[model samples]
Target: MAGHSKWANIQHRKGRQDEKRGKVWTRIIREITVAARQGGADVTANPRLRLAIDKAKAANMPADRIKYNVDKASGNLEGVNYEEIRYEGYGIGGAAIIVDTMTDNRVRTVAEVRHAFSKYGGNLGTEGSVAFQFKHCGQLVFAPGTSEDKVMEVALESGAEDVVSDDDGAIEVITSPTDFEAVKNALEAAGLVADMAEVTMRAENTIAIAGEDALRMQKLLDVIEDLDDVQNVYHNAELAE
Candidate 1:
């Protein structure tokens, strides 16, 4: 697997416990609220809300808490209003980075984000600066030991766009964002469970960074991710393992 994938796996595992748990919940709650506000409280009729609910369930969030947020956002109760924002930037070695946020305070969010970039050896860029380097899609990755042939067969038959096996034996299935839930359900019905699956901004290409540059880039990413308003951080940097 590429170092970026490895790093993502590490973060995924680590995010479930300790201080990161609360941060994870905060981000998920924001997502659920936004999804509900945009669509509706009914998961079956709202794909975005359904995805957010799935993430909440995976994180072991209480059903009542999840419902409360949805109800509040759907106007059953008063709630804070938030706006979605996307910030593009450059990391170590000029690698492209994109930060997604939902905030009630745009000025505060922007300042904190800009400070994080400048403090971490990165430069904040204008809109569309680095977003062109990514494709919005749904991706599912299976471990090295998984059966690639079976995955390919099932995925392609179930509305998947592509199936690719990396050098490290990881199999990735790509799908349109709209087809993500359907494809995922089909895979589960076929007894295939992914190690990682999500709708994301997938990088089209990567910048390889090593040694000191890699360390700095990791630090930059960490700071950006730690920001309260930052919901998701995507980058095109492949760090040295």
Candidate 2:
């Protein structure tokens, strides 16, 4: 994490997401289906499902499509059953990578993921091989030029675990997953809007990857992310901008 720029990283991620907009609905549907199947169809009672629905709305997905997927997954209608899987690996410069997938065919998912890593000179590691490098939590990032003092005061007072403010990086508020919504709501009420927020596998530290290694690393990440079953990818590479 020594040379990692959180703001640049977040912006880069958003740009990548825009390029993958064609597949956004597919991924959200899978997320919605799995969440509902595992935790009933009631969004009010199922936090996971609620978050999935929120993502769908953010993506401008139709309400009926979202509801149908929920009903289908909850057994009110027929649907494919999905199983969650996590794949750990190492990218360029020994940077740790973690992939989260929901799939009906584990064999196919694993093959595709492994092939991507091998193609890019990386290797798929054992489960937990790289998981220890990340912390599972919620993060809210405010853009630069925002008042850091106000953000710190409101975030910490509203259950955020920590607030990291820096001129060269994102003003990040970290929280326990359960405390995430409360802290976000508090920030909003205080007129502090986060540019990005999510529950994620945040890297504890990062490795600098520049020049050719950075290009290879980005290509590797893009390939893995474009896989049909992959929902999210986390890594510790601080790539050159």
Candidate 3:
């Protein structure tokens, strides 16, 4: 809509996805494989793997390719091992940033991540420097004009923690990470399709940035997001609309 909802960010992200389909697929594959390796290949029994598979499907990845990676990670075939890492930092306007990565080469990944931050007007901080500013949860955002009462009724009944409507008319439903899939399914069954839905590290507060600072911050986020080893980038900067 016209405000700072997850849907707005997702629309921006979707616009960027087409130009980086290959890179996006690469990241999704890594996520699927890692999830499978950590929690078996059965989607029904493995929530993380199920979520990864959903992402792969959303990206239009071939089912066979997805299955292959899952098998490889689950020991049916050979695969490269990966380790998950989190990097914290401060971006323009003193806003906090968190980068989540999964890589087979930790040294190379860290160097690349550090270089992006340093070159983009940001400072890479030590572990735990910025993570505390975020809360990890599931978020679903509906576009403006949706029925707030209906969303609230359905969401609360389905285990959502909160249903909030912004000034712009967008409605956001928040839920625990473990209840994400169930809530999403419930919403779908009730014919309430969300414009954006994901499990993410949400910032507790936002720092407004505008003019030159906003531009620099957007560039910093873009470069960091474009990094091959970077999986997810979370920040608390609310760029001027």
Model 3 stretches with alpha carbons more than 4 Å out: 1-7
lDDT of 3 at 209: 89
Q: What TM-score number comes out for model 3?
A: 0.95
lDDT by residue (133-219, candidate 3, tens digit) is 998999888888999888889999999998877666789888999999999999989999898788999887778788999899999
Q: What is the TM-score of each predicted model, taking all chains together?
A: 0.94, 0.95, 0.95
TM-score winner between candidates 1 and 2: 2
lDDT of 1: 0.89
How would you encode candidate 2's per-residue C-alpha lDDT over 1-241 as one tens digit per residue? Answer: 1224678878999888877776888998999998998899988889889888988887889999999999999999998988999999999889999999999999999999999999997999998899999999999999878888899899999999988765475688999998988898899999998888888898988898999989999999999999999999999988887
Instruction: Give the clashing residue pairs of candidate 1, or none.
Output: none
Superposition TM-score, candidate 2 onto the true structure: 0.95
Report each candidate's C-alpha RMSD, comma-separated, in the order given.
2.2, 1.7, 1.9
Residue 88 of model 3, lDDT score: 98
lDDT of every predicted structure (CA atoms) = 0.89, 0.89, 0.89
The runs of at least 3 residues in candidate 2 whose Cα sits more than 4 Å from the true structure, single-residue gaps closed, are 1-4, 167-169
Give candidate 2's whole-model lDDT.
Answer: 0.89
